[model samples]
Target: MGNNKSLRDMQAEVDQYISQFKEGYFSPLAMLARLSEELGELSREVNHFYGEKPKKSSEKENTVEEELADMLFVVICFANSLNIDLQKAHDAVMHKFNTRDKDRWTRIGEEGEDENGNN
Candidate 1:
């Protein structure tokens, strides 16, 4: 809809995570650090799950919420910077998926599977 997203939009996208954050709940710098931390955690989890990295002692302990929060915070921030509504954007994407992919991907899972019940 616009040429490019703005910094304020990014900030708002991220800030949307804190539904009731107080004035002192966080600072810009803190949010940046938290985002990086969450991204790192997610990367580590992915490596443990599907990459070559061996699992850490706490590897099984997934910080899914932390990662989600971090992602949403940045997303809201980005959206706010560009005056984009996440709810609307998300809905649009879902609508597209529902209409276009419902049938396209429905049978993709069997592409690699054997046919006629043969292995």
Candidate 2:
């Protein structure tokens, strides 16, 4: 379950897996709903583990890590269905954050200076 596969590889893997099914991929709206559902499940796990809420004995135990993987699977499926390259998307997002929001947070080591020596 744990590997160093890139986003492109993950997308291909999901595509291959979904290709075997007669239903292939769901509509974007349905996938969006599934993504939301997975997010809710992840949130519930977080609340149960970190917040005041505790799981009852009758409830099935699920780890936050597992919930995150479930959400990732749905995301990969959504991206594959839409012909979107998540690697490029991730790179664009990182570039935006690095440039537009670089100064939005405080640096760890120095005042008014980031780890990359940018002031």
Candidate 3:
């Protein structure tokens, strides 16, 4: 079964998987380091695609999607270790953005739109 799991399901799955291991989850500091490393990998991929840096001939090909998934896996592990529900966290952040930044940016109709209302 793929592509059917929600954020909580994914967290539970990761927790279950890690439960089988003797070591379980890494320490919080170690998890943070792993997250940083994964982020760096993503940044490197982005730099290769959009920045001046070029990938070495010997470097293996990596996609942004793959790196993002890797990062998400680590994030799931972190959240599982801390008993944090990512869905709730996501909702809280969304709420904050919706309320706090609601008027932060200019609305499309505010400045007026093009002939077809395509601003």
Candidate 4:
């Protein structure tokens, strides 16, 4: 963890990087495809590290953290291209989870509740 940066900062950084290129950001469809590709890479890394799937000796070495960062970069680019504020989107998602999904799960050290709202 180097210097902590906000989502806005990350978005700006990506925008600046894309600005230098003649072809700024990819189209939404292309970005989505790229996102899916990154996701697949991340999933493969996770499977190699945690799941039963093991990497072959000839395969190139990679870490889950690196794959996650790659995914984040693509996500930031996608968000920036759409002019969507990730921080605001995150806040809204958090709000929904906090309110609508509150009590949806059991708390540690506390008795679990059933769907009927029983103890």
List all candidate RMSDs to the true structure: 9.8, 3.1, 3.9, 2.2
lDDT of 3 by residue, 5-118 (tens): 889889988988999999999999999999999999999999999999999999999999999999999999999889899989999999999998876766765665544456
Model 3 ranges off by over 4 Å: 112-119
Between prediction 1 and prediction 2, the one with superior lDDT is 2
lDDT per residue (tens digit) for residues 3-107 in model 1: 575544555535564445665234566657766877887787677668898776753577556667667666565455455677678788999988878655426
lDDT of 1 at 16: 64
Off by over 4 Å in 1: 1-40, 49-52, 55-62, 107-119
Candidate no. 2 TM-score: 0.90
Clashes by residue pair, model 3: none
Estimate candidate 3's alpha-carbon lDDT, on a 0 to 1 scale. Answer: 0.92
Question: Which portions of model 2 show Cα errors greater than 4 Å?
Answer: 111-119
TM-score of each: 0.48, 0.90, 0.87, 0.90
Question: Residue 4 of model 4: what lDDT?
Answer: 87
Query: Relative to the unseen true structure, what is the C-alpha lDDT of residue 35 in candidate 1, on a scale of 0 to 100?
Result: 68
What does candidate 1 score in Cα RMSD to the true structure? 9.8
